[model samples]
Target: MIFLKLFRESFLFAYDALRQNKLRTFLSLVGVTIGIFLIIFVFSAVDTLKNNLQKSVNKLGSNSIYIQKWPWVNNEDSPWWKYLQRPTPKLREFDELQKRSQTALAVSYEISIDNRIVKYQSHTVEGAQIDATSHDHDKTWNFDFEDGRYFTEMESRSGSPVTVIGHDIAADLFPDGGAVGKALKIMGRNVTVIGVFKKEGSDILGISDDKEILLSLNFAKNVIDVQNASYNPQIVVRGKNGLSDLEVESEVRGLMRSIRRLGPNNEDNFALNKTTILSNQLDIVFNVLTKVGGFIGLFSILVGGFGIANIMFVSVKERTNIIGIQKSLGSKNYFILLQFLIESIVLCVMGGLFGLGMVLAVAALVKAGTDVQIVLDIKNIIRGISYSIIIGMLSGIIPAYFAAKLDPVEAIRSN
Candidate 1:
């Protein structure tokens, strides 16, 4: 009951102080408001960027691993010349990997050959990225359909003239007519469109969006030789949910060695790359950005904390006579301290809330104006409010203590 009474009295006193000197209160809180806004904005932006990057990387496949001639990141001990001289992984090696690997759930071969104009009667889509893959490609690439179904295993193996077009290609080549069940000319060979891929939003890395054309592996091989180093394909291997990536990688590594007839002493010529590596790189980048942002924000908050303390000191000085009268009326020292402390906390929290509102408004504005989706989640909101209350307590303690210690006679005599 005492705590509730003290709280009500303190809040009323704080409200009255604000009404008496509105400009002074506003000026004191300006620093805190700006400081919170900066810190929250920076963190919010970085998190949004990280989410975008992860989504982009995930489109490729999180559980998939790639076997390629060139390494994604080169080791200091390994010579670049040796990796260059290594033979490109071919259909024969893929066959060997498929037969030998036990942990692999799905295996696929894909190659991006060349860009070409896709023609359907009078419609032509220029500069569409032409891709060729085997039947299991869908498991690794994760295609969502807009029109029809993916090509079957038999069609891919028998060199069927079937294709699946992307959103942009379908719109361009078959604007008037339907894309599925229609014929289009790719690389001068007539191919039937079996499916149209759904529209996927733009990505940060600018890869795997919506401007691609997928065809059968055998058909692509007939057009361009797999022996050519320039047109080398990537072999993707995926493990089931229960399987560890390291186990899958180990199996693939051992199989590749057997296929290439590598001696025990020879270094690994082929590289096994995981999709998570891309996400890992992005995580490192965003972590550094968050730290830098936090460091810059801390300096501003220090200045704001001092500003709030000054405000509390001024409020205490203005109410010294009130403190003297209350003491003479038998008010306890702790009551005076609690009142000033609550008032300071209220002032700081109001400032913090204003800053949070500004941040939210800015994020909404950016999202509305741009293609980017800016977000400020609930966790960050809670963090901002907590910081505000803590800063308030730190700033108010000393002034509240001084108010509590003031001699009743001296405070009443103050001019």
Candidate 2:
């Protein structure tokens, strides 16, 4: 009952003090509000970016591993320049790896032909990205077909003049008509359109997969008139179930080294890139950014805390005689302390709530404007509220203690 009475009296005193100086209270909260706003806003944006990046990486598949000329996540010391110095991995290397590895489920090689002009009837589209991949490309990449089927393994081996069109390419080439069974001229060579790919929405990198074309490995070589012997291929290996990615990667490296006949102390001439490594690197970058944002937001809370302390000091000076009168009326020292503490808490909470509101409003705006996903987790909100309360308690300590210890006779005589 005594605690309840103390709480009620504290609230009443806090309300009266705030009402007496509305503008001063507002000024005190501004620092906290700005600080919380920055912390919340930056965290929301970084969370969105991280989620998108993970999605993009997962699209490549967890079990699948890629072997290319350059590393996916390039480092300063070992740059693309290092990869450029090495010889390109040949398509034969993929065949050798597939033959040697018993742990792999499917292995394929891809070589892209860029800026190719695609034509059907009178319509022409330029700068099309065409990929020449093996029959396993569809199964390996989890590609979904729209209207027709992917090229058969026989067609890939026979180098059949067939093509699978991307959604955008089909729309551009056929326009009013469907693309199935149609012949489109690619780089002055006629190729029959066997399949059209369905649209897969933008990846985490904000890239659409709709603007690509796929062709059988041999057919692509013939269409581009590139020498099959000299062609550089990107090897994609999918490990069988229960086989670790590391094991598959190590096996592939060993096989490639043997095929290329690299000396024992020399590094392998090709680059191996994996999705997991890329995802981990991106995670580290986001974590650092979050910490930096939190520290910057801490400064705002500090300023608000100082303001609360200053305001309480001023209030104490202004209400000296009021304190003396309350003490003369038999008010306890604890009561005086409770009143000032409540005032500080109320101010800090108000600022926190306002900052939360602003963060939500901006987050909503960003979500509506873009496809980025920025979710406000319960934990983050809880942390913000807790931090505000801590700031209030710490800031109010000095003022509350000074008010409680004041000599009533001296306080009254000053007025």
| Separate clash counts for every candidate | 0, 0
Query: Which candidate has the top score in TM-score?
Result: 1
* Per-residue lDDT over 1-415 for candidate 2, one digit per residue giving the tens place of the 0 to 100 score: 9877777776676677678888887788898888777777667767677777766766676778788777777666776666778776676677788788877898988877778788888999899988888878865676677889888878989999888888988888888858999998876788899898888767666545578878888876665644242345688888888887788888878887898999999887887778788778877888888988899888989998999899889888888888989898898998889888877887787788888999898877867887445767666777777778889888898999899889999889868
Q: Tell me the RMSD of model 2 versus the true structure.
A: 3.5
Give candidate 2's error at residue 172 in angstroms: 5.5
Q: What is the TM-score of each candidate against the true structure?
A: 0.90, 0.84
lDDT digits (tens) for residues 1-415 of candidate 1: 9898888887787788778888877787887787777778888988888777777657766667899998776558868888889878788988887787788888888888666788888878777788888888888777689999898988988989999988888888877748899888999999999998999867667766379899988888788875467766889998777887787888888989889989999988898888677677777887888788777665666677788788889989998998999899998998989989988888778878888999989987887887578768777778777777888889899999999999999999995
Model 2 error, position 56 (Å): 1.7
Clash pairs detected, candidate 1 = none
CA RMSD of all predictions: 2.7, 3.5
Error of 2 at 178 (Å): 6.1
